[model samples]
Structure formats: C-alpha cells, structure tokens
Target: MSGPIPVADYMRLALAQTPQVSDQNKTEINTNEQGYYMKQDVFGQGGDFITSPEITQMFGELLGAWGIQCWKQLRGPSKFNVVELGPGRGTLSRDMLKVFSKFQNVVGNDISLNLVEISPFLSQKQHEVICIPSEKLEQDQKNLSPPSNSYQQGFSKDNGCPVSWYKDIRDVPKEFSLYVAHEFFDALPVHKLQKVDEGWREVLVDIKPDNEKEFRFVISRHETPMLNVLRTRYPKLFETSRNHLEISLDALLILEELTTRLEECGGIAVIIDYGHDGTKEDTFRAFRKHQLHDPLTDPGSADITADVDFSIIKEIFSDKALVCGPVSQQTFLRRLGIDLRLDNLLKAAKTEVEQDQLRSGYKMIVNDMGTRFHCISLFPKVLEKYLGRLKFAGFHE
Candidate 1:
C-alpha cells in the first residue's frame, strides 16, 4: 500500500479490491495473467462507454425476433428461457419480448425469462426494460419524454425468471434455449503478452512514485511459471500468432463453454462485438466517457477492452456448429427485418422529422456503428439434423 510493491503483490491487492469478479478468484488469473476487471463499471455519464441497444430500439428489436424464432425452432420449448448475458440497461431483452407479450403456451407454468448480470444499478434499469418497475434508465430518458402510458405493455408468464447475478459461470441457469451475448466478450479479461525473436514476454502494470505518482507498463520475461500454464493449453495461439501478438485466453475459454453449451444443450448463441480476424498484431484499448484514452494513465477510470477475435472461434468449435459471418450490424439487422419495422413505425405515427432522424440513426448504426461492430451466430452442429425443412435446414444440416 506504500511504495514499489512487486507485480505479484499489486495483483493480490487488486484481487482483494475487486468485487463481483469471478475470474479474479482463480489463483492463476490473479498473478501474471493480464486483463479481466469485471465489476460495476458500466452506465451513466462517468462509467464506461454505452452499447448499441442503448443507442436505438432497432438493435434490440431484431435480436428479439431472433430469440423468438429460435424459440419456435426449439418446438417453442414451453419451459425454456429467453436469456441474456450482461444485459446492460435490459433494453435489448425488454424490446425483444415486447413483441412476445401475448405468446401463449400450454405448459404447466409457461416460459422463464431471465437476465444474468452483476451491477445492481443496471439490474434496476432492466426493470424499466421489462416494464416491471416502470422506470427510465438514465434520468434523462424521462426528459426526452414519451407519453405516460405510451410504453408498450406485454403479457408475460407469471413464472418469470430470476435476475441471476452469481459470479461463477456455473451458477447461470442451465439449459437456457436462446442466449444472447452482445458486446460482452470484448470486455472480458484478456491476457496481453509480446513475442521477441527469442520468445515471448508478459506485460505488467507497475506503480511508480519516482515521477511524483503514476503507474506504467513494464515488460517481463515469458519463461515465468505463470505464463507456461497458458502457453501449454493454447499452443495454436502461438502458432497462428506472430511476434508481439496479444492473445485473449479469456475469449478462447468463453468459446469453449459456448461450444459446449450449444453441443450438449440445444440453442443458438449470438455474439456481437468490435474486432477483426487475423493472426495479426495486438488490439487493446481504453475508453472514458465515449472517448478512447491511455489505459496506462488511469488506474480504473478508463474502461479497458480489446478487439474480439471471432475468427478463431470456428476453429475452436471445429465442425461442432454452424458459424455465420461476422456481418455488419446494419446488414444483419436488415436481414432480420429492421427496415420493415421502421416503415411500420413511420406509417403509424410521429412527425416526418422524427421518422427521418430514426432513419439517419439507422444508417449511423451501419456505416458508422455496424462497420466497427460485428455480429456472429453459432448454431449447434446437431441442430442441422433436428431443424425440419426450415430455410436454414439444408445449410445448417
């Protein structure tokens, strides 16, 4: 707590200070491993950046249709759940189920709707999404001000799902039919390391008082025992990767669980994040209030994240599932039916300028947002055999 603590000790203190971080509990993750600082850092003006769903209802609307369709394909699994991982503001989930308010099933209890998240603030915001507590997310949502009763009210089953916030992934409700993870993986902790002509090196954040007060990145040797465990498990990362490359062991492990869920359990997993595919260079970033900043400069104020590597996910799953293109948010939504939805909204009411603004925002989501953000879907390998004569039947099968 005083001066010049070794990286290991600093890390130990960090783990102690970190609340609601399951990954931090791992002994191996706390030491030399880099990244992974999951906590109550999302939302409001001071917190990290906002997501797509927070930007527009269109994003959530399409995802909703996708979830419902998945439910239909799963024989409308009577007891299944429409689950969302890290449902920020719960906007996506709320907007999605808006169209499913009246869905009826003759099951004993009906479907379970669930959201998995850690932040209590965001948790409450989700109630607004479900029209439960009926509150706006940002106090500002109240200012833009829609009519008091304009919020859509849908009929949902009383046997609703609980908002599970357990730290461990094992604690998530098992056997969920459709799971949505939007802009989630990019925020998960990633391991940062650089390779030299000789071998690899681990990166560490060191505190320094020599310059009055500050912390900085200090490169260390790769042969450390901590690194050996990671490299042993993921040699292909080193193979496809080049010198000075950054690897997201976090992403890889998430993929392992994702594939396992799709294979063992029946459902599709959608991942929307910012990144590119390649055995290329590193991609780590820090953001504060919608602006990118130097992670090294600030200890915890800046939101640190990295490029999501969706390219290697197929390789990780092999022939286990159907992996779709990491298409633009614009193209994917257009295919899933955003234009038609907007058209109906325009036809129904509102002024021409309001409708035009919606159209422009839609374009920004693509040429501006979707171009940077990407979406991918993984359908279980066995699903092809099960899907009837649907459009994706032959292709997925």
Candidate 2:
C-alpha cells in the first residue's frame, strides 16, 4: 500500500469508498471510510460544487425539449429508455421526466428511466426526488436480490413512468434511448502522462516517505500500458505541443459502449461538461466547499475531476455516429431558447426574491457555465443526411 501507484488506480481506490447508505458500520462520509463523491452531499450551495441541473430547472427543461425533439426525429418509438449517467440528486431526471410527461400520448407509454449510479446515498437521494413512494422498491432496497441487474425500481412521481437503478451503464437495457451525461465523464479517473525525451511516462501517486497520510506525484521510469494505449488509440494526443496531459480511459470505454448501443438500438446522446478541444494540459484537480483543494490532501475528502478532452470524443464518434456541436454552453442554451424561458419565468415570478433567484440562475448558467461548459450530441450515422437537412436546435450559430 505504501508503494507508488498509477494516478488512475489511486483515484479508483479513493472513489471506491464513497458512501453506501445501507452500510451499518460507516455513519460519516467525511471519515477515512468515505470516498470523494459519496462521502457527503457534494452538490449545490452546501456541497463541494454545483451542477447546472441543481442551479435551475431551466437547464434540465431545455435538455427535456432537446430529448423530445430527438425522440420525434427517431419517429416516436413505442418503447424507449431515458438513461442518465450519474443522476446526481436525480434533479435533471425529474425535470426531464416532467417534460416527458406532457407528451406521453405522443411518445407512447413504454418510457423507462434507467439511472447509472454507484453511491448508495446519492442513489437514495435520486430515488426520493425521482420516484413516487413504492413499497416494492423499498423492499427491494432492503433485500436486494443478488442476481438482479437493477438494485431498485419505482415509478416517477409526476408521470407514473417506471424508473430503475443500475451501478453501470451496461446493465441498462439495450433499447432506443436518449442518453444524458452532464458532468459525468470528467469525474472518471484519468491517468496523467508526461512526454519525455525517450517516450511517454506516467505520473503516479506515491506515499511520502516521511508521512503516511501525505501523497506525492512521481513519474514512472519506464513505459506503461497506458502510454501504449494512448499511442495506439489516440496518436493525435502525442502530436500536441504540450508535454503533460491527462486521459481518462474509463471515459473512452464508456463512449465506446454508448456508441455501440446507439448503433445497435438507435438513439441520441447529449454530453455537457467543462472540457477542451485537446489544447490544454494539467487540469486534474479537486474541489472542497466550492473552492479548489489539493487532490492528494486527505485523499477522499474532496471531489477529484479533470477537464474532458473533447477532441477524443469527436475522434471516437467520427466513423460510427454523427457528432454534433461540442459547442459552448451559452450558444447551445441560447439556440435552445433559454432567453425565452427566462423571460417567461421572470413574468411568472411572484416576488423580488423569486425573480432574483431566476435571474441569478440564468446568469450562472449563461454567463458562467455558459462560457465554461461544452455541449455535444451524438446520433446514429444513418441520420447524418437527415440531420443535415434539418436545422438542429442548438448546433447553429
């Protein structure tokens, strides 16, 4: 345990300990037993950071509109899944489902909600907000069958839409699905690699000799598997002038799974996160109480994340799916009619506090998240021509 390990390995070890609410032994997530994400409430004002969905209903509502449009483009399938990766607090799901409810008759009755989440505490939180009370789901939670892929199941409080929970995306039934991965890929573990005179070397985490609690970064002396994979899978990364970069293999694998599913079953995917077009370097960092924190300090105490390299995403989907705008969040939202939504909300505001809240949320999403975050969409390649013929809501200038 004292030996140096790959950064990705360290991340997995740290995140693996995120809280399981059902675990009787661990009551406090801030303790050594907890991990970065599930250790405590890590979203909104009191948590480590805030996400778009938590910021305002509009973020999810816009996404809901996008989803419905996508569903229509797919010819309004009789049965489809709305699979959300990392359904934090289940806020976006709730918002999207509320939108989905209005068109139940058009989209047909076989809509299912599948959430890919691991933290027991967060999953429970998602359930409370997303699902109506169900004794069956409660019993399933208490005595989960070992063989079932879904650990819990229920129906949406607003629409009576069935919802299911799975720890991994593969467990979600392969069907026509509208996928959402807001801020999901960035949280996956990334291996920091440095380009040396001879070849690529990996930056690893090691225990400081003087203090067991402290950790430091060390470069591997020899070539590693990650280096080889990086070279083979994405040679363009090496072409970059930057000497140091972080790559998330988990993210690529998830994209592969998503692309395959879309190819086979027919679907669309939206990925919204803070990232770059493979131009930047050294973005692996942590946050605690809405401030930047040392990732190695208190290992699992803070949320660890890295900026996504969106260029690689484009590369992955190049041949398989039609990759649409990895556009700025501001542009996407504006194109999606966020301004109109804001105006309508402003009109409906009953008090100054309500109006201020709406305005603030709009500023955060449009002015802050707008510029920082990026949005990308994926559709089956068969729709390439069809998509071109139509003006996609968010991609245009």
Candidate 3:
C-alpha cells in the first residue's frame, strides 16, 4: 500500500501532534536528533561542512601565538587552565599545545587542557588527535584511524597535560583560565520570535494537514514569557513592525557563568564566529554536503546553525570584563602574526604542491570572504594592572 513515512515527516508529526511544542522544543528536536552528527560526518572531508581550523594549520598556530601573548600578559601564571568550548576533533588544542610545548620554559608546564565537547564520536576523535605529537601531526593527518567502538569515556592524558572532557562548561573547575570558542555559539539552539499586533509571538513548527508529512513554521497564538522579557529588555529589537528576531538563551546563560568565573578568577576569553556586531536579521540555516539546505527538510541529517549577535555578548560582559574589538578574523589573525608564520612555513615547504595547498588554505581563512568572521576578546577587569596598558595585537590599530 503506502510507503513508510520519511523520518523528517514522522518527527514533524510527532512534535506537532504533541500537547505543547515550544520553540525550544523544535531546537532540541533538530540538535539532539538520533544519528544527526554520527551518521552524517559534519566536520572536515566526507562531511557536510568544514571549519577554519580544518582549513589551515596557520589558523590554529596563530591562535596559539595569541594564547602565549595572553599568558605573558597575565604575568605568566604558574598554573592555569586552557579551555576550548566545542573543540571539534581537538585540532586547535593540538596545535596550541604544540606551541606550549615549545615554550614550556616561559609558559610553564603546569597547564591543564580542558575540552568541553558533547558528541561521543567527536570526543574520541579529539582524544586521538590531541595525543599525537606535533612533529608527527601532519604525517598522521591523512591516516586518521576510526575511533574504537569500545573506547573509554572521560579524562585522559595528552603529553604532560591532563585532558578532560565535560558535558557542560559548569563542570570545568574554577581556575584562572584562557578560553577559546571558535564556531561554537552558532550551533546552540535559538528561539525565534516575530513582532505581532499586540506584542510578540514565538515561531513554532507544525505539520501541514493536507500534505500530512510536510512541515511549516507557524507563529504562536499568544505571547510567551520569553517574548515579554525580550520586549522589556531589548525594546529596540521590536521597533520595526513585524520584524523577526532570534535569541539564544543558552549562549547568554553560558556567558553569564563565564563572566562570573572570569571576575572571580583572572583570565581572558577569545570568541571567534561568523555574525554581525549588533545588526539584527534572521539567519537560521542548515548545511548538508557543503550546500545550503532547507532547515525543515531533514530532522537529524543536516547541521542547523544561526549567526551570533556579538553585541549581546559585549553588553553582558561589559561590567565585569574589558570587552575588546569584535574585529574581522582577517585583521585579528594578521595582527597576531599569521603572515609571518605562513611565510616561515612556505620556506620550509619541500614541494610545490604542498606550497600551493598552504597558500590556498591561507586565502580561505584570511581573504575577504573569511573577513566576515569576527573575533572578540574579554579580559577580567580586575587584571588590568597585570595586563597593564598592553595593546592586544588583534584589537589594537
């Protein structure tokens, strides 16, 4: 008779027919869907998309240099934490650790590496990569062994540093920490809202009755508590008639905890992602096989993301931390000496093919297309003395 319903259609039906489904529920449905990340290789080759770290070694190397500078500005803390949120495959940390290993005398050897990652598959991949020595990292890059099915879960060691995985940032111990979150916030769930005649209503997902299997966006009938809070706190967002808005409460909550930690313990955090500084626009999107796809087409087969609003982050941490430029990624990396690093690598290149690859990767991350990605740094206000009047490379003119 009739063929079985598609997974996407079945999911939409289940969610829509439920007693109550909020915007948050839709986000959870998409993000935590079974076989989403595991079935579809979402990072690097054979995956839906790739990130900057995947594009070039220079990307991670420059970030490593920035970390070293920050460490020095903090007066060379004897024991500090290097934390990375959503460290995909640990490529960035591995590169940074290589740099730290080189300057062990100056940066000290008492550093602990903390990676906050949720995907079991990604965690295993990170563990394998993080344990590889930098000298051999390039050689072993192509032959990455699939993660063992029976791999142990939890803390492990990489070089001299103790590597630990946590489900949430709250699990990380309270310590003077250097934090980096590259392309992390965009994946977090966002609640979409639209201005209404009365006030504002949340956008929800529902199954089309005639189609029965297809899904469509429907605005809520009444205002939600989140809508009321948004109207009161960010009246400017609602100034335009029928303007659509998106907010990531999860991102703000994490920022609140991070700021509190930075205030209590001296440290700096670097956030780099693609988004506008303060401008508002609907940016909900999906990626499958490196191409844009309809977000509602597949429940768990595609990657869902949205542009981050850096202005909100700056506002949240302004009181407790010195917020630096949300400058273009091009400017930030160049100021941090990416060009010099690339030149040095070029000189070391043994083959013309290798040299060409390096140049291509460099352009992919530092060219006009990549400049849309922004970098922001936050330093605790209490550490101003130790940080002195030091002009951070990326943020300073």
Candidate 4:
C-alpha cells in the first residue's frame, strides 16, 4: 500500500479488495470484496470473458463423455472422484454430471464430485447449478457430520451423487480422481521476469508519481528473491534469446502436485487453456466487457491472465506420468466427435435460431477457441503402454 509491489500482489489486491485502489489513502481497507463476483458476473456475454462451456452445451457434454471414458480406463474403480479445478458457474460440471448420471447403473453409486474453488461467490453459484437440497444431505450434515476436509457437501441434482467443495486441491480426499482444470492455470499469479545485463530482474507495479490511482510497470533495480529461484530452477529459460517472459511458480507447483497425485493415486488430468509451448513471451493482459483492457489502468476492474506455457506442464507431467499431446482444441474436440455432435444437433433444430446457434457455436469453439485453446492430458505412468497402444481419445499419442 505504501510502496512498489510485485504484480502478483497487485493482482491479489485487485481480485480480493472491495474498495478502489484510490482508497490507498485510507488507514484500513476490507480484505474481502463485498459481493464483487455477484455484481461482476465476469463470464459470458455480459461479463468480462466467456468460456467454451458458456458458448455451448456440447463443450461440457463432450468433456463429460471424456470423463466417463477415462473412468472406464481406470477399470471402473469401485469408488473414485471427478474433481474440477476452478469450475466457473459449474457449467462444465453440470453438463458432465448429466452424462455421468446416465452411466449410474454401470458406475454404480461410487462416483463422487469434488470442486476446488476459492471464490465464495463463484462457489455458491456452482453449488446452485450442480446441487439440489435434500433431506439426506441435511441429515448427513446434522445426524452425522460433513467431511472435515470440505467446507460444504451435498448431492448432485442430476444423479444424487455426493458432491463436496474444497478451497484447495490438497484438501480433497486422496482418491483415484479425474481432474479437469479448464482455464485455471492461466489465472494463477505469474512473475514477469526480464533478462537484464547482470541477470534477471522482476517486473513490479508502482503507483504513478503524479496519479496515485494509476499503476505502471517498473523493473526491479536489484535482483528479487523470485529471480534467484528461477535461476536455480530453470537456468535454461535465461539462456533463451528472448529478453522478457512470464513464469508462474504457482502454476509449476500445482502441476507438480497434480502429477504427484496421478503417480501415487492412479488417476488422470485434462488441462485446457490458451497457451504457448515455451516460445512466446509477454502475454499477460486483461479483459473487461469482452474487450482488452489495460491491466494497470484500474485494478480489480477486469480479469487478468497470462498464457500458460504447456511445455512446462509437459515437462512436469512427463517426469511421473504419461504425458499426452498438447493438442489444439480443434484437434481435441474433433477427435472427440464434436462435428458429429454438431450435425446431430443441427438435424434436430426446430428453428433457424437454433441451427444458427449450433453452427456458430461449433465454429467458434472449433475455429476460434479451437486454435487458441490447447488441451493436454496426464495419465499414470503405469498405463503408458496400455494408453500408448490405444491412444487417449482427443489426444494422439
């Protein structure tokens, strides 16, 4: 509040602070935003951004089908988890749960849903869409007790499968879980590093001298702690020709945790995001009302993100698991039969509006998002041979 800070700290402030950055003059400020997410609704046409699931039911349906197929590959475990990280508005989970509901007879009542969400506002929204209040859940909460690991628990409205909420993935029960992280890694805090004459220096945010309300990027005059760690951990990144790039230590740590889970628990993960293969640099930006916005102009007024480096994830996954293709969303979806699903929906359309939506949604996801967004998967290394022979759907080995 009094001095220059890291970009990651600014982001945490922007995302969680209720008062304007101008309120820096105040002695104290509220840490938790008051109904910010409730008012912002930062997804879909009316919000700052829109995800694929918001564009069409097909997106979720296909992912749901993918989950089932993966579970089948897990030998139809007697009990397992379907966990989603950063499920916004629960659209994907809702659609996936619907598909899972149809397979109850085969999967039995052993499937559980666990959502790793940090935002209370979004978590409530997710709960509203994915769960239905029931006497059994209430009884379980009262007569028994909710699991200590979760803040809330319930039953899926679609199939009465047990559903739980966790603030962190580590808190989720250790089970053979299928993890889905759609556009999650990009949102994690990233440290902007620049190659300086001596070494790498961190990019920081400082209040403009003339305008206290405004922020500007400033390079550190001295090496920061993050710079030292990056040098030690990824010395090769410094060897690149590029002078500037962004790296998310948080993202790398999370990927390592996920890989450890898959290696130890026998599970899989599907990660979808718009990212580079360790080639591009300076991709951090913001969006407001579906348009690009200056991230430093008005903090907390927009959604900030950076392109994920899939190469980093691949490296981590490859260490302990069977890393699959970092394929384009187009390739992934087409492999999963999006075209056939679209054709079927088009044939059933009752009006021009429905047909147009179907056609446009298909094109947007396949052509627009399909190219920009990439999908990667991780399976336990034990299945490397089995999966190599058959290949994971939507991802060529």
Residue-pair clashes per candidate: 1, 0, 0, 0
Better of 2 and 4 by lDDT: 2
Higher-TM-score candidate among 2 and 3?
2
Model 2 C-alpha lDDT per residue in residues 56-139, reported as the tens digit of each score: 999999999888887886774778679999988999999999888877776667788999999988998999999887664555
Better candidate number, 3 or 4, judged by TM-score? 4
What RMSD does model 1 have?
8.6
Q: Estimate every model's Cα lDDT from 0 to 1.
A: 0.59, 0.83, 0.73, 0.81
Locate the minimum summed-lDDT window of 10 residues in model 3: 1-10
**What TM-score should be assigned to candidate 4?**
0.92
The candidate 2 region of ten consecutive residues with least summed lDDT is 19-28
Tens digits of lDDT, candidate 4, 1-397: 5446777666656665633445464212345554234345688998889999999999999998887787786785788589999999999999988887787776677778999988878888888898885553665544645666898777788988778899888898887888999999888878898888977789998767677666688999999888889789866556667788788887777777888888888887999998878888889898899899998766677888899888777654576888887899999999999999999999999999999999999989999889899998888888866754656789862
Question: Whole-model lDDT, candidate 2?
Answer: 0.83
Residue 115 in model 3: lDDT: 84
Candidate 2 lDDT for residue 266? 92
Off by over 4 Å in 2: 18-32, 135-148, 233-236
Residue-level lDDT of model 3, residues 1-397, one tens digit each, is 1212222233333222212223332223333335454433478877888888988888888888788888786674688678899898788888888777778777776877888876777877887887643344454442544223322223223445667778788878788889999999887767787777876678866655456555667777887676677677656556554377667777877888888888888787999998877675688887888899887665566777788888777765677788888999998888888889889999999999999999999998999446679999998877556555688878886
TM-score of each: 0.76, 0.91, 0.83, 0.92
Which residue segments of model 4 deviate by more than 4 Å? 18-39, 134-144, 234-239, 385-387
Clashes of 4: 0
